[model samples]
Target: MAATEQQHERALEIFLDERPELRIELDHLNPLLAQAKGETAAQYRAERLHEAFEAEAERLGLFAWELTLQLTAASPQDYQAQRLEVHKEVAEMAGMTWADYCQLHDL
Candidate 1:
């Protein structure tokens, strides 16, 4: 099953709890990590964290959404399945067979 919003939030909480330094790095990288009206500190931090992840993903020549999926997936197998499903959808949109698309992208 796809990850829910609660799961994503929990994952982020756990990730941050495990890596306090990452929060500092994200805050440093994203100067706009300030709380908005009606937004909690956690919410602002989560938003900045996402922005930081997006920047990092772009720097690494990776898709931000895919990176998010990888980060939030329940397991490696789940991530692979979700990733393959995404590729299959993209292949369909591009009017290419899965095998051809996979080969073209070295998947």
Candidate 2:
């Protein structure tokens, strides 16, 4: 798998933790990865995985920003600051300011 795919997969795994029902949805996702033999196919498969993840997230009333906020809120004060800093760095890498990222995601 590509690094990006691995990153997304790892994220999805984290999100699925403690949720067996969500883990089952991953079974539907695995075949797509296996079938992706070339760059174009892999990209297409990645998009499908993204769509699937979004659908499942919506069904569970989960949002990326909400999850991030929950994690930050649950962290120790020192860790919370570190997490926010990391989040801002990630947002910048994704081509958005931290404020814009929060706004865009309704954080």
Which candidate wins on TM-score? 1
What tens digits encode model 1's per-residue C-alpha lDDT throughout 23-82? 677556433435434566656666777776677668877666566667778899988898
Clashes of each: 0, 0
lDDT (Cα, tens digit) per residue for candidate 2, span 36-80 = 654455465556556656776577686544343333343567445
Superposed Cα deviation of residue 26, candidate 1 (Å): 5.6
Q: What's model 1's lDDT at 98?
A: 85
- Give candidates' CA RMSD values in order: 4.5, 7.2
Clashing pairs in 1: none
